[model samples]
Target: MTASAPQVPPRVRVSEASLNVLRSHTDQLTTAVNLHLEGTLPWYRQLTTDERASLRLIAQRGIMGLVNWLDNPQTRSLPLVNELLGSAPTDLMRSISLQRALQLIRTIVEAVEHRLPGLVPVGDQQGMLEAVLRYSREVAFAIADVYARAAESRGAWDSRLEALLVDAVLRGEASEQITSRASAVGWGSTCGVVVVVGPAPEQADAAFMSHLRRQCVRFAADAVVGVQGDRLVLLLGGVTDLDTGLERIMPSFGPGHVVYSRIEGSIDQAHRCAQAAYSGHAAAPAWTLAPNPVPADDLLPERALAGDDTARQMLRDAIFAPLAEAGNGLLETVTAYISAGHSLEGTARELYVHPNTVRYRLRRVTDITGWDPTEPRDAYVLQTALAVGRL
Candidate 1:
């Protein structure tokens, strides 16, 4: 069975003389609480003059609220106390932690309890003391509620800002506004940034997002997460080993190929990384046997086949241009090797050269382009680069 809510007690009935006495001593009580804070709390003395004045005003409000509650015990104290504390400056509320706030409440309670004998008739003093204790308890809960709401609001705002920053990076909008937004979300300037793209988990709720963030921190990296339709995009910074870090957080993604981009030197170049990663994710299905968590550059042939201009240009620059620049018939021999069904003797026959000469040129091609024409996969990439270069 569900538990019932606690019932609030009826308001205490104090005489008019006692209520007037409490009302007349509001300023005196406020000053007494401030003096007690200065003497008992070392941190209270460190506040600036304006902060101290703000605290004085908050304390006065609290005392005035307490007096009004004592006059009419039927009045609800929670909203009244919340309204009183809400008048405090936001910075002051943050500067005074929950523990410090509780201490401040204790100080006020003690100050009131000490003055009860002079403020009330002996017969009514006990009731007044009990009322003060009850009101202080309500004020404590109100303070906690206020801080909790503030924290939740801040978390929500940061999540939206983070999503916007990731979206900006994906769209290649590296403006000053992106930089400022990045800074606002605590994106560090550390180098070795990368973008990882994959299918988002089916249950991409707040708890899952929080777990994903914890995983990033576990690997000593800073990250921003964005969910676009079914895809999850993660921008990670300060990763020393991309492979190991991705491996650790692989479970955070859904069931699909997880593709990451090359390590960028800085965050400003993250857009380039994001472009490659996104292209790779789109083209990942073309290669059924490709490894999960594959590098975007490793999928250049597929990306090029998918009509990615950036991938086409990358292939031309990294493979074709270098081979063309390297002399000794390197480009011509590799072209003939691929065209001749990757047969060294056929390439030698086509070029009217010895097989050994064809072999030497193919080795040079491997050394220059880092793709061995002898390997079937590398052979396909070389063929694609050759075709893209001619275009």
Candidate 2:
């Protein structure tokens, strides 16, 4: 017999007091959050484990301060924040009440979808998500109450912690141990890293960082910035190309986000690449790129330089060592001969000397170097040797 699919438990309705507490706390927290910056949100004190997890998701949305206003906190936070501030959040609160059930459904749906995007919907999530959402609302309300009371104490500590976070990333002093510990906490696969150099025109030492976050929903990527040192060094993970990383970031700001861009290399190579990128920009030099790793099979600069180094050097040095010791005249004469197409008269005319004088010098060079100018190949060899020796 075919067993029927498990039913999703219905949402448990949230109490009025719980809802009021949430609203009040939201308003207070909204006031508490300093809106001057982007990435530095205050450390979420208090709240149960479930609440913290929910807040983290909200924070991932880029504006943890307004979780309820934006249905999809990941996408709609900024615009919704703008809308709420322009008028008021009361209407927003009321509007949210209408979609509470829908929001609960979305939460469960997202959880399931991430593991299996195309799986048939199961109703089990409905009840569980409802419970989680209610718990989160209550947590938010509790946080709000704390904010109202401990605004000064909480804000200061949170700010300090946030600054520390930014500082640690920038310093590149992050030890393998710390990095390993963070890995223990389980960060997802970041194929590569991009270091964003900020162009803060207002101050001498201002910088901006853009940490690229991938939306688990659409798998869309964008940068979230934090302050680093005197500049902002944004660490963007999950992008392969630097250009693609910048493109992902630029449009997310929705226009008026004009600035220069240069990408640092992979996550492993970020420190060096970041410094190089910054130096290049500051010095008006070419942007430094961290070349991707290659196999032994790939040709490189040293490969291109390969050839009869000993022979080439011996011949080249034998030709010019005498001239260099005495003066640049022989060197000059040889260059003139090549430029004149190894023609006696042409070499003389170019050097503003008699053709006989040019011929005598060529003869002397042939005797000393054993490289006869008459041999077209010998002349070519001399020319190439001169060029390579200088380099």
Write model 2 residue lDDT over 138-235, tens digit each, in one string.
43443344334444554445444434433444455555632553243243444454455544333322112112233211232323344444444444
Cα-based lDDT at residue 250, candidate 2: 50
Where does candidate 1 clash, by residue pair?
none
Clash pairs, model 2 backbone: 8-123, 8-124, 193-267, 207-231, 207-232, 208-232, 209-225, 209-234, 210-234, 211-224
Q: Per model, state how many residue pairs clash.
A: 0, 10
Per-residue C-alpha lDDT of model 1 across residues 1-391, encoded as one tens digit per residue: 9999999876677788887888888888888888888988898899888888888887888777877777665555457755665667365576788788788888878977887778688877988888889888877777777777787787778788889988888887856767777898898855788789999999987668767877876665687888888999888888777677889889988999999985647676678889899989999999898999999999999999998999999899999999888888887898898889989889999999999999888888888989999999988899899889988
lDDT of 2: 0.43
Highest TM-score against the true fold, candidate: 1
Where does candidate 2 stray beyond 4 Å? 1-166, 177-186, 201-224, 251-269, 285-391
Supply the global lDDT for candidate 1.
0.83
C-alpha local distance difference test of each model: 0.83, 0.43
